[model samples]
Target: MKILLHNLTRFGDLLQSQPALAELAGQGHRVAVACLENFAGAAALLPEAEVILPLPGSRFLAGLDGDWRQALAAMDGYVRHVKEVFDPDAAVNLTPALAARLLARRLCGEAVRGFSLDAHGFRHESSLWAAFLEASSAARGLSPFNVVDLFRKAAGVGLGPGRFALRRPEAPALEAARLALADRAPEGAAGYVGFQLGASATARQWPPDAFARLGEGLWQGLGVLPVLLGGPGEKALAAAYRETCRAPSADLVGATDLPALAATLCHLKLLVTNDTGTLHLAAGLGLPSLSIFLATAQPFDTGPYREGCLCLEPDMPCHPCPFGLPCPIGHACRRAIGPDTVLGAATTFLAGGGFPAGGYPGARAWLSGFDRAGFMDMTSLSGHGETARAVWLRLSRRVLRQFLDEEPLAPAGQERFALPAAVHDPLAEQLAQSADLLRLLAGHAGLAGRNPAMKDRFLATWERIRGLWTASPQLGAVGRLWQRDAQRAEPDLPSLIARIERYAALVAAFADRLTRR
Candidate 1:
């Protein structure tokens, strides 16, 4: 099979999708990728891709400002060229944007998976995992699966050992990177530690002063020099770091391109960075990283893909904040993680010792690893007891994996489900309601094909069930999966009935498990 993947996203996302692409290639399929022109260079890092198509998104949009007809013509020409060069048997769109959906439809018609548009211009999600991703976008904090896992699942790839890595740059690029580093750093430093100075969003960035303080501590305590890294846009942050700390450091901000950055990361002892593209690049290079997650960033979903990487996030109720929303408390999560905490983690990791076993008052620590099923997993190092939200998130993950992957559920003690009254009571009520609705839908589904009134009643009951689950954050995963199965089973009354009964059994079993616990 010739599979074409459409990922019109940024640098970090492109790097993260490597496992999915590699899986497609490993399965004896020829993989081609279509990405934005600006990050086309990044596509070279994916060794699995046999063909690379760079879409002139920026240039086309730039042309639209002056001449709309010319822009359309150029876009059409590019589309034709893509279709002619690598005619794909299947298309998987990793981007959820409208333009990407339309392009995927044009490229492979009904064979497109993930998100795409129908012939009537109606949006469609072709897989259960895709629907789950769509639902996760709305309830961010509740999602327990890593995005890399979701991408592979959406692309119809099975979960396996996540050992995929980026292709290293050429020998010349590596040598140039080494020479650049040698010229910048002082002669007698023990080794280099990277400080990634910027992130894609301000909310996700750690304070520059904190980084400077950490740098100074690492130099004074561990005999390592701090090598600052960022794109040209982060020069201001670089200046701020220089002004804040009196430590000896080398600033390579805006000095190197993507390939050079990867080559340079190979020499680092460790990378201490905000949640950014550089973090992903360093992970791709197999460089150990200690990444800070704040505001809308969390380690569970978008942490570095490599196992044994360290991740830190502020321990706040409002953490992993919703996207595009202003912080109600003035981004206090920024102050939650102090420089001392990070320096300790950095030193501990460097010494070949794991994270300190002590509790972090305002922050949490996690070590990245793969679970038994080879999905990216995080083990908390903070000694604090699990919160109610964490319990629900864990349960949600188990339930979804059981339904989607046929994984077996482990037996747990009643204490595991001992959520607070405030959380448990309402959730129990909602699950009961959902179970009842599923039963009603399943009972009526068999009669729907023969009787018009029965069909109307069955449809109404189904919508009610949808509304009930959609409104509850805890049950939204089940709703999303059920929605996908129901959509796929439509026009077949027996199949739809089977789906409804299966979901009913799932809810009933879950409710029984909770009750027994």
Candidate 2:
């Protein structure tokens, strides 16, 4: 089969999709990748792709010089050219943007999977996993799967045990990187450790002074030379690190391009970074990484995809905060994690002593590993007891995964997820109410099959149920799961009733478990 994989997102997101691309190609599919032109250079890392279609996104925007018609023409012509060239048997759109959706529909018509548009220009999700991705985004902090696993499921591929090996840099680039590192470091240093000094968002970035402290600690204690890495845009951050730390270090922030950066990463003993593209890049190169996730960044959702990587996040409740919103508490999450804590973790990691057993006061640490089902999972090293929110999120993941995988719901364990009475009562009531609505909808559907007049009542009841899920955050994922199942069971009363019953059972199970707690 010929597959056109579409990803027009950031550098990190594009890199995350490489495993799925590799799986498709390994399965004997002729894979072609369509990505934005600016990120076309990164596409070289995805060697599984037989063809690279770099969409001229900037050129299209530039053509929009107050004339919408010209931009539209250019976009249409480009889409046509892509369709004619690849003519894929199917297209999997990993991007959720409007432009990418429309382009997928134009290129593959109904043969497109993931997000796309119907004939009437209405949004359509061609898979349950895609709907889960959309719904999970609306209710943050609830997702238990990494974005990489979700992307693979969306593209109808199985999760791999490890990340795909990215294309290595040329010999010249490798030699240049090695020479550059040797020139910067002192003679007979232990090894080089990379420091990714920048992130996509300011809130997500660790303080430069903190990085400097950590770097100095590593240099003095472990004899490892710190090598700074980031895109040219992070020159200011590199300068900040230089200003604060008087220790011997190499600053390659604005020096290396993508390939050179990869080459440099290949030489590193380990990388200490914020949540950034460089971390993902290091993961692809099989480099050990210790990542700090702050503000809107959380390890559970977007951590490095490889095993044994360490991740740290603030233990505050407001962590993994909503995007585009200013921090109300003056960015306390950033200050919560101190440089000493990171230094200790890094030292332990480098020494192969594993993470410390005790918890940090205001921070938590996790080690990345694959779960039994082959999905990326983070095991807490902080040794703290699970909170009610953590238990709820874990259970939600288990139930949803079981249902989606068509496995039986595992029996409830003796452990309790103790929520305060005030919070527990309302949530239990909502689950019970949702279950009742599902039963009613199922009965109405069964009756409507014989009596045409009952159809209106069934529709009205469904609208009310939709309103229920919309208003309740706990039911958001359940609603998405049911929506996908319901769509597949259309016009078949028996199948529809069975699906409704199964959905009702799911909701009732939640209610039952809540009452048991």
Candidate 3:
């Protein structure tokens, strides 16, 4: 089978897809990687590929700033490029950009098949690609969905648990990478641990100081040689780690392309990353890894398929938190999983011959059922006058919305106004509690406004309780899990509706006070 893999997302996303594509190649299927211009450099890694076609100006056109007409021309150019070169049994588009979607729609027709991991609609790009694939009859399922699961569903071939046997850098490149770093790697079976510090953005990265601390521990406690790897973009970051660390480690950032990085990674014992593409790359190579998760992003869906890979993240309500914006609470997900926790697991794996315990023990502490009424009980705390004030604020807003047919939701700021003090005054107490509740509601909505009238009252109620206001045009912007189940009947209709109405009243009264002020 000849497979044409179209990936136009960021470099890391394309790198992540390598494992799934490698799985197809391992089956002796002929695979051709069709990538945007920027990622064509990655072709050197997939020696198993029958051909590597770099779409001329494809990346630029993908980012073309013109109207739909100009965009379609670029898409047409890609379609023509794919048609003239060769035909594959299938095309898997990993990019969700409009142009990529349009291209996939034209080339693959319906019935496109590939990985679709954007469970939450927050990632508009991936969702667009998955949507296009779905339109092409190619959608296997929701992506970051599960690479292993996707491969099984799409090709009728189970890549099994762990990273799919996707493409890696060619054997020669792998050898060269290893040879180049021979001086830096640890001797014997203890194996070298790869530390990747570069990410597409600062928001995705935990502080570089954190990586340095972990590296220092790995060297002292476990005797693991830490090879800090990243793309050209990560050189400064990796170099910074090397400078600050008390321990000596290899710095390979800005040194290698995706294939070269994959080759170097093939030699590693285990890789530790902060939810970057390298995590997926290491998994594809069947390397053990640990991923540190932050914000609203959960590893349950996007974590490596490899059983051995450790996912260290906290269960914070704010997590996989909104990208770009710093977490108000300082990103508990990454903060909670300290270096000691990760180092302990990595040390154990190195000592035990390359395998860590099944998941982090701390993670189990935050399980949903475990905290059944913790949230409710906390809300019921009668003593916290601050809580009362928050409630009042929420009630005032709800009442105002009802009165004026207006939404009082506002954009979040580092510091929101709270009652001067949590006092015994009923108005003050209500104001504080409502403010907090309204803030909570805004987070649930993920937009800046309230929900418009809906056919199902349950959804409307959900809007009240879970809505997170991002500000501006009032429209339903679903979060990850909600987006998946929005169409389904409310799981517990009566209870959900009750919560909405109750919250609405609280917000209404709270808004009344604020308006008078």
Highest TM-score against the true fold, candidate = 1
Which of the predicted structures, 2 or 3, would earn the higher lDDT when compared with the native? 2
Reference-based TM-score of each model: 0.91, 0.91, 0.59
Model 2: per-residue Cα lDDT over 1-517, one tens digit each: 8999999989988988898888888889999999998888888888798888999998887888768899999988987787788879889998878889999988888888788887888777777788777667665566777888888888877645545578888899999999999999898789999999899878888999999999999989989999999988999999999999967899998899888899999999899999998899899888989999998788888899988898999988787787677788988888889999999888987898466667666788888888777888887788633655555766676677766555566666663466667667888888878878888998899899999999999989988887787666567656655554455535577877877776776775565556334
lDDT of 3 by residue, 1-517 (tens): 6777777665555655555576677888788877767667655445556778777654454556656677666667766777777777666666555555555556765435543323332222222223322322221111223433333333333324323455656678978987878866556424578888865556567667778888888777767778888877777887678778898787787777766887888888888887777786676567877677665444534566554455656544344454345566654555566666667677876778543334553432111000121110111111222433333333322342232222344423332334433233443444454456644544444332254433344345445433442121111121222333233333464544443444454444433343222
Model 1 Cα displacement at 452 (Å)? 4.9
Which lDDT tens digits does candidate 1 get at residues 157-220? 8567766599987899889988888887776888899999798888788999999999999989
Candidate 3 to native Cα RMSD, angstroms: 13.2
Better of 1 and 2 by TM-score: 1
Pairs in steric clash, model 1:
none
Task: Please give the lDDT score at residue 372 for candidate 1.
Answer: 84
